[model samples]
Target chain A: MSAQPNPTLSVALEHVEELARGLGESGDALALRERARDLVTPLVLPDRARHLWRYTNPERFVPVADPTVLAPVAIAHEWPREDDLAAAALIAGGALRMVEIDDTARRAGVVIEDLHRAATDGLLGSLVPPEHGFAEAINTAAWHGGVLVRVPAGVELEHPIRVRCVASAEPVSVPRVLVVAGAGSAFELVEGHVGGGVPALVLGVTEIAVGPDARVRYSLVQRWDAGVTGHLTARARLERGAHFQMSLASFGGSLYKADVGAVLAGEGAQAEMFGVSMGGEKQHMDHHTEHLHEARKTHSNLDFKVALTGAARSAYTGMIRIAHDAGGSEAYQVNRNLLLSEDARAESIPELEILTDDVRCSHGATVAPLDEEQVFYLKSRGLPHFQAMRLIVYGFLGQTLQRLPATTRERIEALVASRLHEE
Target chain B: MTDSTNAVFSCADVHIWVGEKEVVKGVDLTVMPGEIHAIMGPNGSGKSTLANGLMGHPLYTVEGRLTLAGEDVSALSADEKARKGMFLAFQYPVAIPGVTVASFLRAAVSARRGAEVPIRDFRKELLARMADLDMDTAFAGRYLNDGFSGGEKKRVEILQMLMLQPRFALLDETDSGLDIDALKVVSKGINAASTPEVGMVLVTHYQRLLNYVRPHVVHVFMDGRIVRSGGPELALELEERGYDWLEPAAAAGGA
Candidate 1:
């Protein structure tokens, strides 16, 4: 099949060809490699597209060839000692030592480790489901290292599992993270990505699978350095009676495109996705998410709120898809954004596709500045102009942060508050 | 009835402006302890502006004196005014999302009481009050004033006034947007909160509310000033004959 050809898509295909050549002449890896190569020429890219690169200009995230030479991947530095439950380090292009929890998590049958070991042992394919997009194929072909977590059946974790993935150099960090929750299990997983170096590119990917009757609370806090340019793709699958809660906060990045999505694959499953992003100083952050109902009797809700400051820009696009056989399903999507500066810009679009007549689905979005009444209320309480604005904005985002548990709220707010600027 | 000698709230020839346009001009008004006085006026008569100004709204500027219980509260903030036993049941209450009713009420009560309210005692007291207003116990779990009907918001406002036990209150159009049943419930709430220790100022555009909650006196305002002062019969006279009934007196009052 022919796909639209644009410069960005061409650049992506060129990078895929280089990666395929580096993979050498292997058989099993060849299948995944060939799949990626085929996507390079077939996936269409345009200034205005629906699915991939909707929020961000695909040209900015396209990989450019280097004339010098291939550089070696460096290991990331070890994280400082803290009171965190569990921690892992990914420096450069490889995995560091995995942090073992004190005891509670271990007893709860939580397995957090490096994905290289899991992939080498043929466990990655069984854990995380497959993806069919161009970015997914490119990630499957060139990913280096990542974090993997597995929760056993009937196990409940009181503490959140924290995963820190870092990229020290300019390399496609196909950071694949496979999180599989056994049936009847419940847990929280916090994933963060931090990195800094020269003007380089980092492509990140993650696949999550939540088992039947399981509940998985997942959060992704992406605060890449201001100089980094890249795209990130993450997808999740939920089985029957499973519930998934996803939260994302993007604070800093040069040119970033993030695609986050989930699929309800069984009856009685539910998913709620929440996102908050702030862009400043010419930064552009494109965040797209979708919830697909593939079975009957499923429910899903999505809320995304963003703030654009300075000359920065952001785009939020989300979709809720209900299959024809997925009768008796319910879905809702809302995206609200605030434009803080005249130069700042934000666009939000929430779409719904219902193939069945027995389902209820609705989508809406609003992009505007802060409400005058809310601002006046805060000011009447003695806060200055900027302080009042900050309070109102914080209170706006605090809606999403308040949805988390107490401890999780504490952690997420600490990061969000720091990233917020008074003006 | 209590003595009218007590100074519940005293405004000395107050001049107020909203965006360079004078709303309350050289006006004097007072309400003594245990007295419920209703201020009836036509639209643009600044009745609502006066109520909001007393509550320390930043949207208005005041150039005169305001005192509550012998305390000069002219410079006090809204929350500070609340601590001084002054409350306002806004005509249009703001919806504070992400804050549950129980949490906001508890916090407000704590702030007013300056002490932590015991959970059991709080729940017991809140449930009793909810029953008084015919509110479902589940209402406490929803977000504060979020998605509440007009009548429900007014009930919540009165609920706060009742629980806070304020010394002076400004009920701004609290009865403007309620059905007969809701009006009865709201009036009952106001009547319950009206003890000899509290004084209330009811600012409304309609005299229909006066039927449920009788006031000792009613004042007619026009052109940013109170043009005439009379008994409760003045309200009925104005409602029946409309503001045209005051045209002759308004002209004779020297404008």
Candidate 2:
């Protein structure tokens, strides 16, 4: 295990094969997993100074392998009411337990199926970048089961599709999901990640595809337990005239690192990404955002914010890359960090690689203690110390929170406010 | 006379320092109930410094004593002084993005009262205050002071003063940047808050705001000292004669 490279850490092919054997899958998935493991073995591990794993060690996310068939644990989850959802998926112990679709969506030719069957039919690993990263490669080789949602062309779904994933398997749980938005269709997805307590790891990945003229909104809210180590990747590809809006909010996990990105694959594609992260206690969080412009006349905007209290720390990296032939593209990125305690720390790095002419690209990053003047202003209004700081933090996160579904926004706001008091 | 214990608010030999500079060199002031004391000064005369220091801004180190309604408040924080009936309308209010004016005022009002204000009463009063200042009620829903015009920011400060209803109000250049129409409305809001139980101190460089909200006494403040104190006509005198007449006296440390 110690001889393994840093990229895949100690997770070798034996671990991958062990998990695959437990899944009891045959043929096609076998070929993909084998191919993924081979791709990982010979590849050079990414250096922290080079990219990605600067603040976190990848080995911490690689848990001990149970090497047995995944059986469900007695963990509990409260999913949104069926009436409020176009469809819902439940994944437990690295296997899809249920996929429920509304009659309206069924009539509109929307398809929601188990990821195992989709991969059996060779649908897995199609949209996620093949050379995504080392952790993603391990996920590709060892991921057991999840869900896939396909919205047919020209169909507009009124309700959001919700996916709930729980890490019931001991030590390590790898969950994956795929989403397809057909041409001229409108799709909204909300993913809720929970479970996995002390001494557990949940390596999750989600891939999204937006067809031409499709409009999609994807929101992933992560609430892993305090002792869990999480490595997550979620990325999307946009076609011609497609619009994608994503909200990523992180609140829990002992140590977590996430890679969220989008590739503009067609002309006139637009992606608007927003992030809200608050860390407390001894938690450590690292986030990386990527926007790749592969087509002309594309546009992308990103705003990611972090606030930390206690001895918590966070690192944020934002990258905007415009391909050589991709002209007339516009990209903007902004990152803000607020430190509530003297011991809390934050680091922000913004990188932009513009290769073409006639493109507009700008990036900004700011790190500061909560504005003293603002806190004093709120305090002078008669609020006590904690209430004043709470109000400031609330307002700081309010912009991105306003972009979320009202109910979810309220829930997260309450959770964040309560956590502020706790700290 | 201020030692009589009947004064609404008073500060004795108060000196304020912003780092190495002593902006407000030892000064004494007293405000009787319902009486407005106008501290008129030039741009750098430290009038704002005095107001902010009296309100206990942490950046300014204050020496001497401050009493609000006969309760010593020199050791209290800004919020503590607020709950004890003190408020300062800033010369330049800071922008707090994403905090709506309505919600900010609600929290402040609740803090002042030491309890949450009822929603019905809060909304009703907020709208009423906004209307009194010639501000659209929609303004309450906007982020506080974010991208607000100069006049709008001044008006919101006065609106907040009205909402908090502090016993000792410090209007620090609250009249600056306000046009005649806005000046009139803001002055009206100030006058409405000046009751027998309240004392007011108006800090400004110009007398235009005095036309609508008359001050009972005017102090010619220069070089951090009060060079002259007199009746309301003192403001007119300073406006007509300018401040150079008393420059020597102020620079010499006192009237």
Best by lDDT: 2
Writing each residue's lDDT as its tens digit, candidate 1 over B1-255 gives 233246788778788899989988766778788889899889888888888887777778987888888788888877777777888888888876765777667766776787778988988899898899988899888776789999989998888877778899889999978999999999999999989878898999999989988898788987677888888999999889898778666567543
Candidate 2, true inter-chain contacts retained: 0.67
Clashes of 2: 0
Tell me the interface RMSD of every candidate, in Å. 4.3, 0.9
Tell me the TM-score of model 1: 0.75
Q: Which residue pairs clash within candidate 1?
A: A76-A91
Query: Using alpha carbons, what is the TM-score of model 2?
Result: 0.93
> What is model 2's DockQ versus the real complex?
0.74
lDDT of 1: 0.74
Q: Among all windows of ten consecutive residues in candidate 1 chain A, which has the lowest summed lDDT?
A: A121-130
Tens digit of lDDT per residue, candidate 1, span A1-423? 323575344534344445434534245544654565565555454435554555666556545642112345645466664545533434345443355665777766677765544433343433232345555555665565566688888888776777777755654455667777889898788778778677767777777888899998888878778788867777788899999998887876688888888889989999998888878879988888889999999999887888777888887778788999999999988888887778988877776788989998888888887666665443333334565566556666778777765555676677666656523
Colliding residue pairs in candidate 2: none
- Top-TM-score candidate index: 2
